[model samples]
Target: MEQRKEITMSRLQRFLVVSLIAVFVATLAPAALAESYKFGASKPGGSWYPIGTVLQRLADKNYGDKVTVEIGGGTGNLLNVMSGKLSFGLASATSIQEALKGAKMFKGKVAQAKKVRVAAVLYPNYLFWLVWAKSDVTSYQQLKGKKVNVMPKRFSFQALNQQMLGALGIEYKDFSKVNYLGFNDAVAQMKDNHIDAYLGPGEENYAPIVQLATHAPIRILSFSKEDVAKMKAANPGVVPFTLDKTNYKQKNDVNTVQTFLLIITNEDVPAERVYKLTKTIYDNLGDFAGAVKAFERVKVANATGDMGAPRHAGMDQYLKEKGLLK
Candidate 1:
């Protein structure tokens, strides 16, 4: 009996040791193997945030909790990705071009811009220059002496605003007052009659503009063909777009310029990793479109459109594997 008891104790000790080892390995395995990534999304009250959230859900779910979404803007995302602070983020075609050339918005960041790469082309963003219907400001030229909300500094919208204004021979100093605010804040200021005009980019029926229209009648200022031509000449990524009455309570379709939205990533991201992400998104396009209506326009064929940035190798590999690229 004494021998048997000693043998049982020894077995129990061995079992406990093995159990502890198993627990220890289990606790560290996920952290050791998971590929963590920081995804930069747009700020609050913008469509990019929600779109990024959807991407986060898909990436984390499929990649095993590897991605974390954070607030970012178009120009900021490009700069951050180039700086390696973000793994990937949203940008616009025009912004990418501007950054690459160190012109307009980017000014002096040419070398750093090379560090950023295009992951995918998502959709088009329409420029909206809004005013109260009661206001006598009828055209973009009239915005010269009016207070305007150009969105926060470093926002792609602000850069685009300046570019469009510059094309028409207008300057920030020309405005009576310039307020750098975000979507919600800008809309609030406009509704309160604190600002004479507000400008930004968004898909049709953008939420902030829609909300503002509900509170008070608003008009979408249209760009003349000549003005658009000048902008396109300066920014090749700029394209003519129209917002029909269905988009807002307007008398006719509002003519504006648009820029293609892109997913920009750091050049250091592994090609295999980018391939995985690209494949995952393409396979789940329906899910993305369902979550974000703007994504309904996304297509695998359009993913490789020129956005003035070098395409990542992983994205190329995925395209090749799918016969989308040779």
Candidate 2:
């Protein structure tokens, strides 16, 4: 009888150990099967790249393990994702719209347009101009006929700048001189007081803008309700916005216009994998905010903001799971 009781106890212990092993494997099985990916982003020092680095860092610690990030052009990033050549990319909603129609920057209708999918809306790209605080440029309208650097021709910011001017019924040709200069030259010209204003968009605490503020008190031009409406009217994806007065060296909140910046991927990735990536990002935004200032504005409400391209089935599923898709 004693021998039989011992045998029974031994069998029970073996069974319990096997069950725990099976449960552990079940929990981690998906991660083991998870696919690695490359993230295409803008050049280093640009606002977009920092977000990508944070993304990969979190993904590597989660399921999108060892994800590779690349610095590349906007059009190529989105196109590569759709073609399955890249795992993911960052792009603006407007650019994705153009690609869908094979218009503007794209030669024709993109062959892989259908595969393009949205992961999340990172933040809105705000467009405005800035000058030293002592300068008398009072409003966005006042900049008309002033010597301004609207960024150079290579960045494709020229057309966007033209749209901002058109909203105010001003033409690019109307400026005293529309200098197609780079950021460094713009800052140099600003310090020398050679230029009256520098008009462009970037993160509120954009390094160059912040650097300029260090040498001279700077003021970013603010848009009125009516002008913001007109600008958004002319541009479909843009939304009216205001900067926090307390942050980024801003003395008062300034009104502006914003276009959605999207994290995009393709249909080739499995639904479950994309779901994990989307879920992780939204859940861990606090961790990423440390990497860039723009992150402070990444609200959950904007997670489902329209991005022209359809949402990946995986991302959509995650949203639905969290009750964010309603």
Candidate 3:
């Protein structure tokens, strides 16, 4: 009996040692599997920033600190994704098409376009032509000979502004002074009357416009049929949209043009990781929609919509499991 008891104690000690080793390896497994991915988003104070932040938070929750979000412009996002500088980025569908076509700001980078792929289609971004309500500059044509902020150079909004303005026979030279600024700086300049107009594109109730309006009433320039036709002629991606007074109270609905926003990924990202990333976002979409009003439109049905870029295989697999794709 004494010998049997001693043998049992020895077995117990071995069992405990093996269990501890198993636990230690389990703890380190996640860290071993974690691969860092860089995510690019729009500048601070813009809608894309918050959207990207929410995604980053979700990724951190699901995969630890394997994903990092960085500030990037629309055009820059596409370029960086192509160059493998970013694993993924938020970009407009129009800009993706422009990159693929080597058009507009993407003139001369067509070869790199093949590296970009669509991860998800997020929402629509409306082109906002904002001027102080009391200012005399109410029309796009009236922006001529006036100091204006056209966003930063090579920005997707700047490209859109140039395209639309080009259709109307307007150019940066036509403005008394053209300032290339980001969202916050443009809003600040507009508030101080340093700029007569600010041409940029963003989701409805974009934060910068909301902040600018609190200082002084601002008006969103409407697009006429002729204007829409001209813009569409310049870029087929331009679509007519009616901006209602949900966010900004206007007496009447404002007519404008809009483009879809998408999440783009580099072709080299692993299919399994992309699948997990898509699952993370799709599973916690409520958190995203809660953070950004624009994200409310993100749905499984629309997540895989054509955004002028090839769909990532990982995203496709997730959509297929949801019965969205064959």
- Best lDDT among the predictions, by candidate number: 1
Q: What TM-score would each prediction reach against the true structure?
A: 0.87, 0.75, 0.89
lDDT by residue (tens digit), candidate 1, 1-326? 99999999999999999999999999887656568788777787878887777777877776665677888788888888888898888888888778888875567888889878878778788888989988899888888889999988878878888888888899899999999999989888988889999888867767888788898888899877887899898789889988887766887888889998888887898886777677777888788777667778888898767777788998899889889888
Q: What order do candidates take by lDDT, descending?
A: 1, 3, 2
In terms of lDDT, the poorest run of 10 residues in model 3 is: 245-254
* Candidate achieving the largest TM-score: 3
TM-score ranking, high to low? 3, 1, 2
Residue-pair clashes per candidate, as listed? 1, 1, 0
Kindly report which residue stretches of model 2 are placed more than 4 angstroms away from their true locations once superposed.
1-32, 73-76, 110-114, 134-159, 166-197, 224-226, 244-253
Report the Cα RMSD per candidate.
Answer: 5.0, 4.8, 2.8
- Kindly list the per-residue Cα lDDT of model 2 for residues 34-55, writing each as its tens digit: 6777888766655767878888
> CA shift at 192, candidate 1, in angstroms?
1.2
**lDDT at position 59, candidate 1:** 72
